[model samples]
Each structure stands twice: as structure tokens, then as C-alpha cells.
Target: MALSVIGAGFGRTGTLSLKFALEQLGLSPCHHMMEVFANPEQAPVWLSAARGETVDWDSLLSGYKASVDWPSCHFWRELAAHYPEAKVILSTRDPQQWYKSISGTIFPAMAGGLPEEGPQRDMLTMVRHIVSDKVFSGATDQAHVLDVLARHEAEVKRSIPAERLLVFDVAESWEPLCRFLGVPVPDTPFPRTNSSEEFQARLS
Candidate 1:
């Protein structure tokens, strides 16, 4: 199935929660970085894409109705063009908090190397190429990283048609998202997950 929702937001910007929220809104099978970790077969395909090679987006993302966060977010432009009908979600947060969250969670995680070679290792490698090098330009300084985040958000807003994009913050919850997708808001509370502490605990 083709993607109906494409997330242009970087990781640590409430993407994990957005994944669940989207699924709850009937967009199940949302793709996230964690999906690659859970499925080894998907790693190499992403690694290939990370290296700047053209890929069959459909084959790679087959069965997924939506995508969010890293790896996918890194290729948002391509995915947007490929799935023209898909609406873009630019998930965001306070700039300083976004920096702090990534600093505490994903930054150190990607800085370390896996002990042995495997699919997960390959996945980390792809992430490093995309997140560490390409996205952040290999600089983790507060100034630089925050700048990248701001520029990314601005670019998404500029490139995607205003009508087709929703600048979302998970804190705002389901109404905005539900309204954007033309779906009824669930009676259930929005999914709020993957906080910095939880992310650190998982890595530990």
C-alpha cells in the first residue's frame, strides 16, 4: 500500500508518539527507525538509500501506510514526490528542548559502535551516515545542531504545499492530526511516549 502520511520531522521530535497516534487514527503500520531494528531484512535496503543510491521506495516501504523520524525523515523529499497523495507532517518541538533531548538520547547512542557486525550494526551505520554526517554535518555543537533543526523545519514548510503539510507537536494531541487526515478524533488520549529518560533507559 502507498503511504498516506509522510513525516518530515527529525527524530526526538515526538516521532515515536506520532507513530502510535497515526496508527490509532487508522494509519497503522507506520514506519520508524525502530522498525529497522526489529526487522533485519530492512536494514540493508535503508543502508543503500543512505549511501545516496536510488531505491524502489515502494518495495522498501511496502505494507507501511505511514513513515516518520529518521532514515525516513532523511528522505522526506523523495518520499513526498513518490507519494504525491500523501500529506506531510512536520512534527516539531521547542528548539532548545529538541536539542537537549537528542543530546541526551540519540547523540551518544550513535556515537558508540556495536560490538559485532550484524543487521543492527548495519542499521546504526546507516543512521550515522544520515544523522551524524549528513544531517548534522558531523558537528554536535549546540549552535550547529539547533541550526540544522531550524533549517530543516523551515525547508519543510517552504517546500511542501501549505495545504498538504501540518506542523505538528505531539503535545497538541489528536485534534490537529485527526482533522488533517479527515478522520474522527479517537476518544482515547493521545500516545505520549519515548521521553528522554525512557530513551536512555532503553539504550542502557
Candidate 2:
């Protein structure tokens, strides 16, 4: 299936919640980093992409209707171009809060104990190449990270047509998202999940 929605946001920006929200909106089986973990075969593909190699996007994401978070989000431009009809969602949050969330959740986790070989290691290395190395330039300083996010948000805005993009914060819940995607707001509450506390708990 072609991707109907492309998440252009970095990780730790309510991406997990957005994944579930999109699924509930009928974009079921949304692809996220979690999908990569569950599908180890995908790690090599992503690692290739991280190293500037080309792969068939259609085959790689064949069954996914939407994708959020990393690995995919890093390829938003290519995906958007490949699937010209797809809408882009630029998920965002307060800079300070975003930095704090990643510091506690993603940064440490990436640096923590990881398998020495195989798919898990490939995934972690791919993540490092994409986020820590490329995006942040190997700097985790608050000011630099915030600047990168601001520039990334601006780049997405400039690259995508205004009508085709939604600068979303999950805290805003369903209204703007539903309106952007032209889907009815569901009766159930929006998903709220994968908080820093939850992430830390998972590591323990």
C-alpha cells in the first residue's frame, strides 16, 4: 500500500501517539521505530539507506499505509517525492521539552547496552548515523539540538506545499489532525503514550 501520510518529525515528538491515532483513523498498521524492532530484516535496509544506498521504497514499506518516527521520517523528502499524493505531518513540541524527552528516553537508550551483533545492533547504528551523526552533528548540547529542530521544521515547511502539510503537536489532539487529513474525529480519546517515564521503565 502507498503511504497516505508521512511523518516528517523527529522522534520524541509524540510520534508513538500519532502512530496509534493514525491507525484509529483507518491508516492502520502504521510504521514506526517499533515496527523496525519487531521486523529485524528491515534493519539492514535502513542501514543501507543510512549509508546513502538506494533501496526500493515501495518494497521496503509495501504493507504500511503510514509511517512515523525515525528511520522513515529521515526519508520524508524521498518518500514524499516517491508518493506525491501523500500528506506530510510535521510533529513538533516545545524545544526545551523535546530535548528533555530525548535526553531521558532516546539518547541514553541508544548509548546503553545493546546487542553486539545482528539486527538490533544494525538498528542502533542506523539510528546513530541518522540522528546523532547526521542531524545533530554528534552534538547533544541543548542549544544545538534545538537549533537543528527549528531548522528541520523550517525545511519541511518550505519543501512541502502548505496545504499538504500539517505542523502538528500531539498535545493539540485530534481536531487539527483530523481536519488536515479530512477524517472525522473519533469519539475515543487520542492516544497518549511512551512518556519518558515509560521509556525509562522499559530499559530497566
Candidate 3:
């Protein structure tokens, strides 16, 4: 299935919640970094893309109805171009809070020194290459990271047409997202998940 939504948000920006929210809105099978861990074979494809290799976007994301978080987020431009009809969602949060979330969760996990010879390691390496090296330029300073975040948000806002892009914050909940996607809000509450504590626990 073609992607109906392309998430240009970095990981830890409530992306996990957004994944569940989109799925509930009928955009099921949303891809996230967790998907790469679950489907090991997909790692090399993303790794290749991270290394600037050509990839078949359609085949790479064949079963996903939407995509979010890292790996996919890193390739938003390509995905948006490939799936012209797909709407882009730039998920964001307070830059300071976002840095805290990542520094405590993903950054530590990436630096946790997990075994170097497994699917998880491969996935982490790919994320490091795309997010750390490419996006943040191997710098972890608060100022630098926040600058990258701001710059990315600005770039997305400038690049995508107003009608085709939604700058979303998961905290805003259902209404805007529902309206943007032309879907009714669900009867249940929006998903709130994968907090820093939860992410830390998973790594342990």
C-alpha cells in the first residue's frame, strides 16, 4: 500500500503515540523504528539509504500505510517525492523538552554499548548514521541539537505546501490531526505512550 502520510518528525517527539493515533484513524501498519527491530531484514535497506545508496521506496515501505520517527523521518524528502499524494506531518515539541527526552532515552540507548553483532546493533548503527552523523553532525550539545530541530522545522514548513503539510504536536491531540487527514476523531482518547521512562525500561 502507498503511504498516505509521511512523518518528518524526529524520534522521541511523541512519534510512538502518533503511530498509534494514525493507526486508529485507519492509517494502520504505520512504520517506526520499532518496525525495523521487528523486521530485521528491512535494516539493510534503510542502512543503504542512509549511506546515500539508491533504494526502491515503494518496495521498502510496501506494507506500511504511514511512516513516522527515524529512518523514515530522515528520508522524508525522498518519501514525499516518491509518494506525491501523501501528506507530510512534521511532529514537534518544545525544543528543550525534546532534547531532554532524547538525551535520556534514545541517546543513552544509542550509546549503551549493546552487543555489536545483531539485528538490534545494526538498527542502532543505522539510526546513528542517519540521525547522529547526518542530522546532528555528531554533536550532542543542547544548543546544537535545538538548532537542528528548529532548522528542520523551518525547512519543512518552507518546502511543503501549506495544504499538504501539517505541523503537529501530539499534545494537541485529535481534532487538528483528524481534520487534516479528513478522518473523524475516535471515540477513545488519543494514545499517549513511549515516554522516556518507558523507553529507558525497554533498553534495559
Q: Estimate each model's TM-score.
A: 0.97, 0.97, 0.97
Give per-residue CA lDDT, model 2, range 1-204, as digits (tens): 899999999999999999999999999899999998899799889878877898899999999999999989999999999999999999999989999999888888778666889887888888888888878898888999899999999999999999999999999999999999998999999999999998899769
Query: Residue-wise lDDT of candidate 3 within 46-86, one digit each (tens)?
Result: 98998889999989999899999998999999999999999
Error of 1 at 151 (Å): 0.8
Ranking by lDDT: 2, 1, 3
Clashing pairs in 3: none
User: What is each predicted model's overall lDDT from 0 to 1?
Assistant: 0.92, 0.92, 0.92
Worst 10 residues of 1 by lDDT: 112-121
Model 3 CA deviation exceeding 4 Å by range: 112-114
* N/CA/C clash count, model 1: 0
Q: C-alpha displacement of 91 in model 1, angstroms?
A: 0.1
Q: Can you write out model 1's per-residue Cα lDDT over 1-204, one digit (the tens) per residue?
A: 999999999999999999999988888999998888888688788878878888999999999999999889999999999999999999999999999999999899998657598776887888888899889989999999998999999999999999999999999998999989999989999998999999899878
Candidate 2 versus the native: TM-score? 0.97
